[model samples]
Target chain A: MFLKNRNIWLLAPAVLLIGICFLFPVSWLLQRSVSEPVWGLQNYITIFSKTIYLGVLWNTVAIAGVTTLLCALIGFPVAYSMAHSSPWIRKVLIFSVLIPFWTSILVRSFAWLVILQRGGILNDFLAGIGLIAEPLDLVYNRFGVLLGMVQVLLPFMVFPLFSVITRIDGSYFSAATNLGATPIRAFFRVYLPLCLPGLATGAMLVFIISLGYFITPALLGGRGDIMIAQLIFERIDEFGDWPLASALAIVLLVGTGLLFVLVNALIKIRGRGI
Target chain B: MTKTTPKGGLNRRTFLKTSLCASASLAALSIGTRGAFAAVDLSGREMVFASWGGSYQAAQETAYCNPFTKATGATVIQDGPMNGSKLRTMVEGGQPIWDVVDVTDTFLAANEELFEDLDFNIVDASPLDQAYVHAKGIGCIIWSYNIAFNTDVVGENAPQSWADVFDVEKFPGKRALRDRAYPMLEIALMADGVAPEDLYPLDVDRAFAKLDTIKDHVIWYTSNSAAQQLFVDGEVGTGVLLNGRTFDVNKKGAPVDLTWNQNIRSIDYLVIPKGAPNAEVAQHFMNATVDADNQALMANTLAYAPCNPAAFAGVEESVLPWLATTPENAEKGFLIDAEYWRDNLAALTERWTEWKLT
Candidate 1:
């Protein structure tokens, strides 16, 4: 839009930087991934034929699905509470939601690892209280992975839902109440309908992100809980099998993205109908 | 924003200095290359030796860097944990970053393009043996991965052998193992009755079965580093790990012991990129690296035995028991068949994943 001399001159530098930093590396990575192996789909085929890889993929989807569900369940209520509260309460609640987000994800994941590890604080507390005679297996399991992921990704779901919830008019609920609707009935007709968009957006964000999560699963999950990201990383980092890793990455992107898009479309249609 | 040196002035000064530095750097680079196979006096030139950045790595720099610089005039710059891919990129990108890398022989075997061959003519090769040469002295250094246990956790009924490591009833505590499948599987198989000598041409099914028995007791580390940290954290009573790390805990007064009866020994080597600009200089540095004095310095810092046989003369007798290459240590442990693994890494690693999870 700006055809001015200074602005036109700035475009050259901006384009130069973007081309150098982003385009060059991505192009090289693409070329390497496709060519590094036997130049065909051998690496990609290996991903499907490989039972371990498929199992890891299945576990990754399962963990992401569970995490997204948990985030939605926990986040929905908080968003509801904030939406119904006074402005002061809403501000305080939002601040609380954001407090943990400021800390590093690594720190948060490590904190959960400590709590969930065998002989960790949680196990010690349980044993001390005579709840169990021995420390139960906790960390390095599916449970630990879920716990860490839910903590890291809860805010992603909550905030988007909060935005939509806050926009829901109190008048709509009051009118439904006045029109012979019970509190629960009024909420179903008004609150649920109003919060649909935010819920969809938040759920999609969480699901898509959970698909790509690397650190939490690797750190917390046991051997059986290996995820796609870790597998892709291993292919490239450990084996130096660039083509295979790229193929894995490509599959992950396509599979996770398609599922997310399909779900988003379904939700959008249903929300519109409601 | 106020009165300051103009853009032209700044550019001119920068240009002049950069040109001077570039010429000086070119001359130094050429000199190092021309004397590639010769043991040139390192007294004036600064040399950068790369390593896996850690405590022992720090010791290597302290013991060798300062002393080597003082005595030889080679200002040593210690860099890195070995990364073959990253090094390749640097060499390919037109700037050679590291001259000497402290990497494992396994890595050199897997990624042969990343390191310069040792100049055996100048670098003393007399200390190394037939087995070591066949193993490729630069690709991997002779090192051990052994069984370690917390003395306090196991008490008087300490693990006599790796059989003791698997004895849940005897050594009753969480057992940790490195996340890798290579040496760990071998340890598991040995515990399951496979002779160490017969471990070559690995029996996949038997190895998996052995691993399965301890899967319940074994806390397999996804991050190898986590194995040590877990033991140090007192979460695990017993584990199989790199002897160096297990030794660190013992040195630090942790109640731990290393069982080398069935320890795995392998070499980690050094190499130059296939088309590296610094290949010639790298070869010179490699020559300096394998020198008896320098290799001895590496041993003192790393605790892992030095590759140069001559370096053994410098290694103290007190440390001989721990060095992987000592006649005592070498007699017990067999060389890791890297060639077999090199041929079957892809297939076997896939099997390793299934075995670990299953």
Candidate 2:
């Protein structure tokens, strides 16, 4: 703290980059939201009053919530195994999780369509095996959207849980079991609670990322699965309605900010309790 | 003709002047036998030509841009899979990289201010249909939302109308439709028994009601490429698709085909963006797009109907039936109302989203 005069200059380039690239554009967007189509809160008013905007907002949150829940459920066991397994097994697990991440979201979404559409490879294979007489509706629905999003977002959940679980002492669970608690009871009471911070971090990452998803939902989801990002794109691309688009973006930003603050407060409260 | 300027300092105007002088001498020598581009020679100039990339733009390059270069001596640099918002931003920033951009009629109608007015002296729109010509742009191709189907899926019972497409019992299975509001509303109304001529200031409530009946059956597609794939793969039995997109898949031996009944025609326009670096060359490029021979080549390759009526003479016999503007085909369909869409796009699109959610 005493010798920080020159050390602060090291932050100069990053600060300058953020100021020019991010902060400037964000502030400009903020200004555009209010100033366009007459200087008032008309854009925000329209967003709030309109059922279309409100519905899409609800859809975005609902989809993100479901996606986060799914990632957490699927990621927990895999992450637990990765953390507890031998070095070679851990390497294999990490590679499997990360290899898909390297592929573009657009390509992955298209791949899902190829595999999951009604006349796709899955249905053909299933029909060949006499699993069913009729092809099932797979892609182009809420289910497909979840499947696509969960696969892409699972890594965000797993890595955090893996790091946290590895750091956790194995004695916490053994101690609970020695105190006359059953294995399941000991795991739930001692182990799960200890993993909460990592779970919260991963959930936050997945939920927030899912909230702004565009390509996966557009490609995989049904008509009703339109999200806020898609709406923003349509406003700008189709109509060139920047004011409304900017207002929608600001709403998303503010909503995510509030959620983040709420989660931080909850974590602090839990810390105090402990 | 042999005059040389000082090395390394020839600006655009000076180069144009030098070319003009050279052309003047050549024209004088040729006397009464002046070729088509006798007055103009853009030998040293170059302009960027932007369009929706893929086979469509590739066909345009072979048909329009190449010929324009041959006639005018200006190089046309190909760019873009044209995106609307990016074009708007580029023009608003007053430094558009693209000189001539291929845009839809609706986009041209909505954002007229973003484009340069056509220099009538340079671009001759006389050969084209008057309806296709605009003050800010020239119609390059006329395509339509057609009642398309996979022959394999529908078997012997082919869908001939929008009503049949809406009739699940008639043509059973999942059907594809565009995810936009403009044409969807129009399509829904037409399916509900509204006449083609009567589809103006559209009956919105009635359209939604019609759409609701087939809501569960529809596979809404945002991209035309995806729509083509759907038809090609026999995933959709019958639905609405663009005429050119249908032709592309069908040419590749896909079982897909289309009907001309109640097709909704739309135009793609080539416009010079405001403050474009080579607006002069772009204006001449527009003239080349209207040439009968070039337009015929485009129609032959893509089956996107040419705006120039004379281009039909050079069109192949097989491609004639697929074209939207053939006399018999033209009588069966109507152009989409770009003005109405320009006014109602935002409001109705919101309503569309609300309807979908419900």
Candidate 3:
């Protein structure tokens, strides 16, 4: 009856589009990962076994994890301010957070370079103020990579937390305090738990997106900052080794998928217990 | 895709007048040259020419494509910003959109099977140096990664060799190095006191060891544009950069300059993709690229060295010092062994990644 329902026809276009655009390509990628250079899991084996690939995979996960953590730490405060601030201040805060989305990521990365390079504006200002004798090495390091990524991804975390924080009644905080809880304890117990859904969503968004980041890290990062995406690109672009690139892609996809599922399960379990 | 012409008579008239003037000048250039492509009647024929875009490709359009178009009456539709994988895919799919493509020596060497063999009957490779000539492609330009530095930063103490670049204690600043396995390995070996000729089958371990010596002091760049930025910004006192890129920044009054000493020469070859539709016309266009005057124009514009030796005669006196193929400069550098790279690029690149992590 559900299949025969006329409303089911409304879903046809979306299903066809996803099947054509997403599923087909993913299946093709999956097929290539196993099929090319002989039919087996040799490509995956190489990726896992090789120190080069394993190192990059670790770098990718580590960078993404750090970026997600930074986003959550920074976003929590900003989202709180947006939720609690005056109407005009909220608008200004929201606008400022979303401003980065307007500009291209490449432009933003280059802007960071201009601001953070040894001879760049930030160094000149710092040196002018006699803060230090020499310009600090800022860009072209892990710091620069994380700075660039977090700037671009801040809104992703902020907006979700803002939406969730806005819905959370302030009376719950007052009630917890009235029940003889300390302000910090009340905020942590009542406020933090309420923010979990948003924090989880934001962290997942930032981490997964940051995992596939190519330009920001490539432009800003140093020698050791190579990510899995860069490796995949090199394999495809330089070597034209599609099989290996495909295997790398599948690995990233599967890893991200597993993360999504694990987080969802944890969230569901927590929801039932509460 | 057919380009839509503007639907206005006055604009069309101006366009015709401009093209006619261009054709007239091109005709005069052909007449004055010895190796200029003889006018061929290829009316109504068109072909795609692809290269790495920006000023370099613009100069190529002026040097190679314009003359070919004018001489043959064949429309040359410029395309790309060439991508290795995209080109390979097109060829493997058996319907390459590019009739002609400009690729690095390493790429051409590695993917030789993906290219159509040059039609010797159509492409007269005589005027060009035999060494630059290949069965699969024609060497369009010879450029090199030279020891480059900021004149303002390094002052009178320009780095003379890769060894000088590696000696950070002597130079005392960050140095920009190309972030690739090929020439970096060669440069490191040469820096480690290995002779240029003995550099091949690279002592990989020795190269990595040598690279480790200055790894802290180095700013590795993946692109020449980034390398130029490093030099111009004085972020690097001395390092390695392409001869042409150094010339570009120097010409722009960036106080950046390069030494031809111990330069690592590499080439860009123009090749036809395996299933290019206009293979015949692409072969004819190769003649235009080999012409002494065209090569000279390219060298004058970009400071990329001409493959045809005779082209040097027409090159500007000032431009000569910047060219990688100048007799003196050519002697100072050795061409990177692309064949060796073809076999080792993938494996060594992985090793390079591993080395960089360490």
Candidate 4:
């Protein structure tokens, strides 16, 4: 009994750190949501009732979902290649993926702005090549925002998926191949199922991070792309509406929490099926 | 892992005692140094002065902060690009950190409870423009949002008015505007031919309709620096920019030209946060900052106009036209109605968000 309970005690420091740093502040914010400016749930009501707020919330969710989907589609093949490649090639690929991580997000966003704006490098290149008569509107819109977000978030997806893919025994593929299955068949039956946990994890990480994104979208995207984070920032910075901002934040928190739970439940059901 | 026995006849307990003694002595040494440091006669008081950063803060440091520190012997710590929410949070948490903040008059007017009432005696209101001096704040800088264009792109046919900014057919390029709703609406109204004197109780519907015409050609800049960068990079042919930003870029020989026609002028104020840790020292700092010579120095450095009328005495004649507060420049531009905005900003902001999304 003593030994069994000792492991629980080992978790105390981590739990205490989280309580002091994250949970305490969050709880205070939650309390403020319902208490400030005459003390009621009016802030939440206003958020729910306002079409603009709801539109922003929907826009945030849509952008996150799309970014996650794109990351999964793009990152899976790259991560798989990295996992199966020669050691030297794998190292090069890994270094390339991580090089972006070392660059500041602001710098990356501004770089994208330079490359995509009118009369910018991309436009100059295209014009020089006689590809078009006019410069393309490649930035300050949804396309620019997506490009920036995917660039910033791609490595997040790749690293997790790569770690998981590398852990799978190489023998599983050999065994499947020996059982008269084609490479594609082996991948679908043996490899794809094995990649699920990492896929889900990478998707979840990308999605959650994208949901709270402020700078990339603000800098690159059009007015239509104003996310929840920007709205919350403006509420506090421009309007001094803390209660409303808190209420909006709580809504985002609860929504993200619900998503996490839903994803975990789906994973569990998939596990049972396997 | 097996625990290694201590060497040199020093056990764990003895080592711990020695280390503890060493740390205690180190702390005592630090305290002694701090005491010696306090001998400069500021009563060991320090105050935080919050302002927008970059060259602006650097100029303030040289023009205002250093002078204040020299005169009063009080330690002044510089902080921020002022954040309204952080100030609100600090005040709400009952541990206000910033002693004084530089903020727009609109912001100070909106968040009155976050600041302490200014005592005229302490703040020395004599040098300041009486129109800008308030119960809760003293004017720090008066600036304008004017029509600024890249001369290399626009050349001799540079946009001279807000209407030209809205006329993409004539200009034939992207135009940048601030992301905020404030001066945009005012500019839109002006572009639509509303005279300056007849501008308020603003025709919001008309402004939105006029804005719709150029919405496709518009790119929104989130900050002054971003706007300046856009101009310097030639990403936008013209933009509605703060006078200081255009001045900085032009000073750097960026071919950015400023036009004061239909410019919207506003005042930024310096105020002490409610329950600031060093409110008394903050008052002294404020008084020093508003001195005519300091204001002129700040104006010369940043090209934003000084709040003190007497500052003009110190400004060079050639630089006067560039300033927002010059009688000629001020006469050409319209004053932003802070009182009207104080009442209608929230509603307009909501509509502005919806319009942007659409």
Count of residue pairs whose backbone atoms collide, per candidate: 25, 0, 0, 0
Native interface contacts retained, candidate 3: 0.77
Question: Which parts of model 4 have CA positions greater than 4 angstroms off?
Answer: A1-4, A169-186, B1-46
Best by DockQ: 2
Residue pairs clashing, model 4: none
Writing each residue's lDDT as its tens digit, candidate 1 over A1-274 gives 5677556876898889999996786677666666765566676677789788888788888999999999999999998898778999999988888877888876877788677777689999998999999888888888888888887788899989988877877899899989999999988877787888898888888888999989887778777777888877777666777677777777777797698789878887987787
TM-score of chain B of each: 0.79, 0.89, 0.92, 0.85
TM, every model:
0.84, 0.92, 0.95, 0.89
Cα lDDT of all candidates, in order? 0.69, 0.88, 0.88, 0.83
DockQ order of candidates, top first = 2, 3, 4, 1
Q: What would the per-residue lDDT of candidate 1 be over residues B164-187, giving only the tens digit for each residue?
A: 788788777678876677776677
Superposed Cα deviation of residue B235, candidate 4 (Å) = 1.2
* Proportion of true contacts reproduced by candidate 2: 0.85
Sort every candidate by lDDT, greatest first.
3, 2, 4, 1
**Preferred candidate (DockQ higher): 2 or 3:** 2
- Evaluate every candidate with DockQ and list the scores: 0.37, 0.73, 0.72, 0.50
In model 1, the runs with Cα more than 4 Å from the true position are A1-39, A84-96, A102-105, A180-182, B1-39, B42-48, B64-68, B90-96, B133-141, B309-321
What digit string (tens of lDDT, one per residue) describes model 3 on residues A24-126?
A: 9999999999999999999999999988889999999999999999999999999999999999999999999999999998788878988999999999999
- In model 4, the number of clashes is 0
Order the candidate numbers by TM-score, best to worst. 3, 2, 4, 1
